[model samples]
Target: MLRVHSENELQLNADVLVIGGGPAAAWAAWAAASQGVKVIVVDKGFLGTSGAAAASGNGIMAPTPENWDKVLSERYCLGKNLANLRWLERVIEKTWLSLPLVEDWGYRFPKENGESVRQSYYGLEYMRVLRKTLLRLGVQILDQSPALELLLADDGSVAGARGVQRQKHCTYTVRASAVVMANGGCAFLSKALGCNTNTGDGLLMAVEAGGELSSMEASNHYAISTAFNATVTRGVPFGWASYTDEAGNDLGGYINGRRDPSFLPNALLKGSVYARLDRATPEVKAVIERSHFIAFLPYKKAGIDPYTERVPVTLVLEGTVRGTGGIRIVNDSCATKVPGLYAAGDAASREFLSGLASGGGGPNAAWAISTGQWAGVGAAAFAKSLGASAHERVVYPVGQAGLRSQSNTVETFDSEEIVRGVQAQMFPLEKNYWRCEQGLLDSLASLETLWQQVQANPKQDTVSDVEFSRRAAALTAVARWAYFSALHRTETRSEHIRVDYPETDPNQRYYQATGGLDKLWVRRDWIKDAMSGDKPQNVKVVTGAIDISGKDVGAQGIAPLPRLSGHAQLISGDV
Candidate 1:
């Protein structure tokens, strides 16, 4: 029960424009506002409760020195020699600093008698606290404003963004000196718990504006419920619970009696997986209840007692969150090669992990908070450097067609068809958790067809239809990015399990896919062995002219995103 702010006025002439309302975007707004910079945060939904940020069953990964060492070691082992160690070390350092700020903002981690309490993940309380903090600091939030596309400057830097406002059928642009792309990772491609707003807005917008993305391969099935379509309270499965098949066989035995992201999904090939808490000791149940109180409500509503019957589950497809991948920022300052453009949280953190793997939950949340601050502060400094030149640049010239509210028009594109089509195909048994070259190629072909529909269909002459068209095209792009990257990565590793390339090959090592989906490229080899400034070879190249260079609102046409420059650098620093 967080009190989300009502819809806000269209705030313009901003120093920074953060595109999401989740924790990372909120944190970015807080940092920028503290610097006396004009900041505005817009979202597809409400400020505090939007996206997976407000979801239950997530805990802060505190940077205790011992846990830090263990977590890094495990993640690196998964990343092989290709891990970006520097960025992770930075996250560990900044997370502790951030917690105190959260506490000062009237947020609290569970504690007992002056001692800190450990949680598997912070639940709803975290989102409420973050929203409270942003409002207290006088940060402006435009909820229900779904950003349709990034507005680029003459020099190819991000000038701002354009999106349609809910209720009012008007498209608006907020001008800014610097832009922070912090929308949470893409979801709903598979039936999962992430907000509907997480349709890869940040990823698609960034790549469209010439930013690079990695770990798209990680955008596979994550935290899927073993019981298909059964509503579980928390989308992520708790590690402490016992997992069993329909026949009451132990699932954890397959993975050394521990919670595993990959092995658990693989076990779903058995009869439906179910989790039970009936056998846990009273002490353990207390902890589970405290961290996951919301999870119990679903079982209660179903007229089942968790102390007796096990709940059924199935996999939910949250490509960005579960895959731990997103828009790749090149520098430690959180700036992409596109200059004023910046990315944080799930959008940029996956750059530090190999395309083949992802760090688990605690680390993922930690990255969101830390990188949010990093991008915010860095953006502030960059804007300050612009000095006289940092004046707000407007993207939409006066009087765009969709600006006026209209009535009674026929819908041209079936948006529901596009959304449902992606979710159904992305999670099919042959492709989602399990994969091979042919299956991936088929998925890519289907996604391409969706994009074709986006292009061929004429936009209706109404305001709402215009907004719908932009969103449909954007979501289609999101799926295309996921499938194309997944198809490009040849070897199997971590959550990206491919039946064809069943084993992790030493030859493939750290080669990762990057660049725009229009013209995709995988790095020549594992980045670990490269010298101080050695250039990377382009493994595969497809060149289609990418023409997204429009500043006016009329640029929303669904062209195959301009072919990437083909020279956009892939993973470099902090390895």
Candidate 2:
């Protein structure tokens, strides 16, 4: 068991600080430590057992040198020409190189026909190896320490971070030269396997620290899971499954050959939908069980064989955890607009690879490895330039809203109420999964009401309860950004479907960058214009405080975020 740091050691210094426990955080710590820099990784859970990847099976997207062109071409077309080709190429190359390092660390890949096949890996095994390797490389692992906010220097660059150690019931402050946000993405507390801790904590922290988010409209990704349980929703075994209505009638073209991802969600909206893997052959069934043992455990415990029995199914809203959207990175080094702050894995927007769509497993895994290394290298270089003087800079805690009451009224508010309110809007299939203008507007209104309450009263007096309070605020922030960006897009493209405007607009070939607290805003950056070095313009549609009318929610100004020193661009209106 990992022991908690001593009281005196709580407030410490490091060259690089990573805020996550998953593969991406481990890789970043490994990369930074390799450069002879002191690295510390703080996680919400145990290093090897946390995150979506640690609870399920995953595959990496690594193409051979000869197949690079063909793979990139297919992906480019699939992403509707919105992907950055160079970034995709780099991810492929870097991920291909990084996989061998895992094997060299003593993780033997399964062999077939006298050769090793390194396509997929079990979540537990992969994360355990990553944690072990990172520890061996002298990276400090601080488990059960969920970061609440980022510390910004007087010059507007990220200086360090502060969070509470859940087990110790004490606070921790790490003043580092650079910080990496690899803390995964929000799943709206959907109870997905390995995603309990992924509540957009880092996303909120980054945004509060004056970082911009991109492609958040593409965050409404849902996966098939057993209706009786919420933990096992990897969506792999469903490829061989057959779907049926409650009346036992075949729901043709639902799961097996379904092109539209929303087809099943639409069906479930009408009535209960059930699935069975009766179509899978014996060989395929064996493979499925072996690959997804955790997913089948629930079925076995319930005395049901999923391969033969009919089990009711529902769509699990993956949110941004499996979706493409997060803190927008400005360069290939995974550097965000804020200096000394980097984002990797699900914590960062994946639009450079998947555009307005989710890359599912393979691409996401490869992205984690590739981007993690780049961020680590970038952070190490920045720290080196700052040298020993890094700690001398005066820094301020930028946490607000959830940490303290934003209003003087101090209305009693429960964190659970905020979570339920956010989930009610995001989890329902009719609202977020298949969105229209009216539904979105209504949802936003309700969410804004909840957000106002959270800002007024977080209802946390103890350190351990701060995690829940922060989670509520983070989820609300993520939901608002997603909906605001969705409303701005107005056209159906990739995962962002607008029912009112049900056609992909050829002219609207742009990415939406969104961020703001009290007043949300979305900016449109045309693909061609961006390639031509043209500046993106904030859409004039809804600007200046999306006035929360008719609600008693008082006017709460945006939190005083650290003013950037002309090095970073503000996404929300002028500072």
Index of the highest-lDDT prediction: 2
List ranges where model 2 is wrong by over 4 Å: 1-9, 254-259, 529-575
* TM-score of candidate 2 to 2 decimals: 0.90
Clash-forming residue pairs, model 2: none
Across residues 1-575, which tens digit of lDDT does each residue of candidate 2 receive? 01223455379899999999988888899999999999999999999998889887888888777888998887767677577777788889999889889999878789989776778888898998999998888888899988889999989999999888877877889999999999998888888988888999988999999998889999999988999986788788888888899999988764464545777977898999999988889999899889877878889889998878999999898899889999988776788878999999999998888988788798999989988998999899899989898999999989876777788884657888889989989998888878887787778778788888877756556665677887888899899889877866778988888889999876566667778788776665545423323323453332212111111122222322232243123223333
Q: For residue 169, what is the lDDT in candidate 1?
A: 52
Q: What do the candidate models score in CA lDDT, each in turn?
A: 0.64, 0.82
Model 1 ranges off by over 4 Å:
1-11, 118-122, 189-191, 226-271, 353-355, 388-411, 458-464, 517-526, 529-575
Model 1 lowest lDDT segment of ten: 544-553
lDDT against true structure, model 2: 0.82
